[model samples]
Target chain A: MSRVDVGALVDEARAGRPLAVARLISLVEDESPHLRAVAEALSPHVGRARVLGLTGPPGVGKSTSTSMLVSAFRARDLRVGVLAVDPSSPFSGGALLGDRIRLHDHTTDPAVFIRSMATRGQLGGLATATPQALRVLDAAGFDVVLVETVGVGQSEVDIVSLADTTVVLLAPGMGDGIQAAKAGILEVADVFVVNKADRDGADTTVRDLRHMISLGRRELGPSWRQPIVRTVATSGSGAEDLVTALADHHAWLVSTGALGRRRAARARAEIEAVALRELRARWGGVRASERLDRLAERVAAGALDPYAAADELVG
Target chain B: MSRVDVGALVDEARAGRPLAVARLISLVEDESPHLRAVAEALSPHVGRARVLGLTGPPGVGKSTSTSMLVSAFRARDLRVGVLAVDPSSPFSGGALLGDRIRLHDHTTDPAVFIRSMATRGQLGGLATATPQALRVLDAAGFDVVLVETVGVGQSEVDIVSLADTTVVLLAPGMGDGIQAAKAGILEVADVFVVNKADRDGADTTVRDLRHMISLGRRELGPSWRQPIVRTVATSGSGAEDLVTALADHHAWLVSTGALGRRRAARARAEIEAVALRELRARWGGVRASERLDRLAERVAAGALDPYAAADELVG
Candidate 1:
């Protein structure tokens, strides 16, 4: 489609047309040249849904836990949007696209919309255009948008800043339960889940988590206590507790006027991410070699330092 | 230190002062204000290091393998630089800061420089200032700079464009080995290492790797073949073979002019990454509230779609 067509499609989608929204998300994600137009068209109708990020080390039953959460939110009769951020397929250069396999139970349910996203060569955990996609979901009237990132390393932590509320999931009996505390997991978690709690270490995990929370309380002035919830997602056990924890967190957010603060922070982050992406792409299209060669020559000669060379190149 | 002092320190490091280089790397990784000056001063003496990025799923023995590789390089009397990227802390707002612990053996070896970098809340797998710090290592006379990303999601794939050669490490008995292959591991791997090959499924893992390699060969040209190396990193068994494989990759790079190509690509990617980061940080600081409030209104009113709105915000 022409760039103009992409723009119009986004405009139509913003006007309460679901098909348009879906198509637009596909286009933006595909990174057709028309993405700019489409984003412009849809810009007016986005941003009401609560964006919750679910992240942790893999094998933590994030998908299963996420499925249970989706089900729980659905039982409340809320329209739910799930964005499973998978690792991209090297062959196709797109997301591995396995959310459907994990969330098979929800495929037939119309109230639930699941979209899988790949970084598609974007640097961050979420795709560069994800904020745009979340907007489309929000504009579509979905009550909650769950972003499930490929939870491997720091990407899980990166995803937290992008969401309104961040839920970090951990499975029992794995080294990750202790890792969750060391890898800065405790800081970003608004709500924590120890999934597959039927396992042997569930109790110890809970005790350890409570101890960690107590430690955090010492420095955070009672204002930043992280809540822990237990779940056996395979049987959908403890799902209710998770939902209740979410509600309580939401309540806390509203009561403390943190909701607006959270949203504002996200918006700012989004803007920065986009701007940086644009600048990078632009720089990539320019005289990169000439600049590098000059810098390299000076660096090799011991006349100029590497850091200074970078500033000069950017300047 | 004043920015001028930072600049002079970087300059001294560029002139081959070891202590100055270490101090400069710390400033950059920590994002201290002094970093800007160091970067500015060292800009000329950077980009010479042959960057090698190693990424894999957790428990793939990436760390142990890395330690072994560093030792191997040091054995050849080559100066080595290691950057181990971990997730940054949310509450402390700091990175885990444990590069020394991970490569404890290298602490006393002056020829081996190990820097532990936290994701520092950067969206991408690599931190915002990583390239700069790596440049410092390069300019400081390290012949090879090994970059270990917090391999989490699709973002890890970017390492291919950043390193002179990219190695994807895997362990035996992980059911997800095939899944990882399908998830883009095969595409980025210039050299694949079946680390911890002493395990039971080591042979099977090798066979599976061959099968996956054949599949890739069918689609990609024969020239794109990736060699597999097996190593038990703990006892340093097969470490020599692993080093040989790295040498072979390097030779291939020089013979085919791939070394220049890799360096050029790295320079470009680094530029893109840095540009995006700076733009985002500046934009976040400026457009924080307005973007959020406007987005909230649009979403509430159903006037604009979220994705499109995100696009508009970026525009």
Candidate 2:
């Protein structure tokens, strides 16, 4: 965590050294004391990577789709960085061995880097850590950074805010149409991908999605209509179509000046999260504060209301 | 919102008036300006109701199971309050009409009250609002409050923390063993309910769960082992067993002194959340801050880092 070591790691990461990139990301994930220094050092080299987000429910072939998309991006000679985020798991770093195994095809390629993140049991940990890790990959000069999160909860939705374009994947016969609507995925999706298209009821899934989209059509005035693409990710079928769809969405974002807006929004959120974390630290945190313990006891004992207790503590 | 009205509402709610309880919950949901008055008014009658949490992934007959449990509790003549929290939906208050329809049997019962809560599109809205609503129900003299949340994300897990006992439901043929592990449900569940037990793969599901539980056995010393119960919720079969399991767990919690610890922990979290919200309001919030906007612009444009910007804003 020394300043010299941090500077050297950033320099090496900027030069595309995988080990250095991994080290920087580990520092971010661990929430090291030197995070501000690391962020400051990596600042200049960021804002260059195109971030694409992919999310879907369990058993939806999100990993396979990510691998297929990686190959497609690589074929276009883009250095890709993949962040496989599993918010449901409390274990972080290398715990998602299955995902790493599935994505082993590019492990030996110097241009490709993959990492898996878990919750680590910290409240709002992924929401804070993911952005910093994304900055590390961005600083490492990856041309396209793909963030793949298991879409089980709000954490994935929060992570998707960091992406320039977000692709929401769904598979057939999972009753995913209602789930997509329920999870509020339709509002955030830039491109709809009906993966596992070879399965039974694929057409029904697609048609149902189309109907849902039509029912909640985006308003006019530079609005980009979300297009649905079908793919058998296991066989890499229709990957080219997905790539084209992504490119078209990216083009629309730039043409409509939405990309900058989205990035600014992301930055705002990141700054707010960090600021709140700092304020919490200053208050000795909820766990460490004796005053909080006393207030909580009173609240639990019905001697005081939580709001009044909070006021006394904050005041 | 006046102090007089809040006092009258609290009096009425304490008298078991359902309309008064619902109005107070609506005020909490809306983040009403008079929330402090409402909290203060409801303070004396709070901390009496036993809170039970029910959560599971979709298609596991959660609504049916909930209905069955409600009937069982009511058979004992215990006044019950039900809170159906849906974090995925942006709409709040009465939007979950389907759930209401499924729970129609208890609508006319004077001893039963049911409510539905959605995200309302506010960050941490449920985390803050739910406890207040729970306080309302607790003060309204309900013997027990059942908090049922759709287990789609971490938000449900957070809500489960408020309960004295949490029941996690799973069904057969859904590959839910791995899913339950992935979603960290194993760590939170006080009891596991294998609903739809008449399904083809129910035995396998139960065996797999047993194996997983054995592998991660809890530590000794006043530990309460989580029990698994099989149920066909559609037919109300095994409802009595589920009730007995819940009662056993509740009694264990009381005898082991874990209930107080849990409530204290919940209160600590609640206070911290409220304090943080107050701090954010003081800083003009993330969206409204001009300083945040300028800092975000610089970070998004690669001229500054998010951590440094956060420090500046916080300072």
Candidate 3:
């Protein structure tokens, strides 16, 4: 491939050229050699977009909800970007295809840009790639960037926690309350979204969440109380209420100066992940390193301890 | 604190002194400064124990099943070590208390060792710690070491995948078949246990597992077919059957030479994790680095891209 002009691409992306934006995000995803150049070019135009994260279990209608949110944001004359990240399986292109079908309404809208990303099961792949993709969308002048990840895996949760406002979606009859509590979702969630509210047991789900929030509030002591918004995303029911709740959370974050703290924390994590990835690559990674293989053989044979093996490999 | 004589501790641990074994595991868990000495001292005596991993979602009776296995192993004149690892919450000692209660039958048995470990929510805590603890148990002359991790999180699954024979447990009415598939349990399990077999839906659960197994067998192509054992663990009804299944799996692993492959892979992961941890320590870790904080500030303010900031930090 010929060397691309990253500066020109950045200019075009900033002018809302979708192809340029897509190319920049692809560079991020592929970990291209020009990734540093792309990042450098996109740096100045970043940090203006309000990054929102949506996460839930598999059957929670996350894609439909994301589409609804895009429509809501676009209705307000704001350009929106959606990144559907699947951390569960590297080979599951099924998630992306399902997302495309659900998000068909925004396919032809120039103001809406949607992309799906899979980690390909790389260690810290989502951590390193998602933030860079967000930067690309931000530089492209999107007013809001929504990062939607499936499942409750630690990596997925960590990615969503990077957003300025994190929305945890739950559906009735999924036993999601227990699952959510088990996954420590309450700690990371800034907004609780009870999606698929048209189903039975929705009221109970909402009440259970409210009760859990009350219990948590005692320990948190006068912070932002996560609001439980009920939404039937298929019909766009309660879309306005969900949007208002997000706006309220954002306003609270700005007023309390938590936005800066959250963003700095997110940036800290991204930089560390990138540094670690680069370090691993320098050492030929854990899988392909012959030195690692020899040490592992000795360790497996009980001739050397893992720690000593690690010391030798690092040396 | 006085300096520990790791050599003496190893000698006593190998002599089957419970206190010495406990101290070595504690050293590993605390990431003590003498960790290298402990590892070196225990290295020669490691790699003998048959490591068995038991994992499932909560309410599948994992602790009860582990206790039953301990009884079965001890009945055959083998020393058993149990490590109850809870990856869900650092502060939740509830799992340990519950495990102790369920395992009360072996509380006074000298041949049975039980330890409960929490990661304290540390990054890669389980990845680096569990194997070292396994070494401690192995060096202490345990014939069988059972690593029981609660939940089906990625880290929990990764830890279990290190074992020679991994058993995934499920109870009737838990919707665990779907949960297991979602967590990629199908790929890791060497044996499947349908615990709480006396409950309703046990037959359906077993049939569902059999169907899933058949579907998976096409890709696996005549490898070890995971045997499904039904047991009411509370009554120890099928404890002998479960034990026989484990023995069969171990035999298969030895015959196919997969045991050596699995152990080497486990060692590879351990050595790589230790090397990365040491490297992170050298850089004062991602959490405590002043350089990282400065770079994060710049990146958050849009003055620098994360990739460029990472390059500076790594340099």
Between candidates 1 and 2, the one scoring higher on TM-score is 2
lDDT of 3 by residue, B114-161 (tens): 887754344566678888899999889999999987544456666776
Question: In model 1 chain A, which range of ten residues has the least summed lDDT?
Answer: A88-97
| Candidates, ranked, DockQ | 2, 3, 1
The fraction of correct interface contacts reproduced by each prediction comes to: 0.30, 0.67, 0.64
Query: How does candidate 2 score on lDDT?
Result: 0.80
Q: Is candidate 1 or candidate 3 better by lDDT?
A: 3
Alpha carbon lDDT at B148, candidate 3: 86
Docking class of 3: acceptable
Best-fitting candidate, measured by DockQ? 2
Per-model CA lDDT versus the true structure = 0.68, 0.80, 0.81
Write down the C-alpha DockQ for each prediction: 0.32, 0.55, 0.42
lDDT of 1 by residue, A176-244 (tens): 446645667677788989988989989988888889878777666776467789899878999999888
List the candidate 1 regions with Cα displacement exceeding 4 Å.
A2-21, A33-45, A88-102, A124-127, A152-155, A284-315, B2-18, B30-37, B40-48, B88-103, B122-127, B218-220, B277-315
Interface RMSD of 3: 3.3
**Which pairs of residues have clashing backbones in candidate 2?**
none
Clashes of each: 34, 0, 0
lDDT tens readout by residue for model 1, B43-71: 65665677888877766767777778888
Relative to the true structure, candidate 3 has a C-alpha RMSD (angstroms) of 4.6
lDDT: worst 10-residue window of model 3 chain A: A87-96
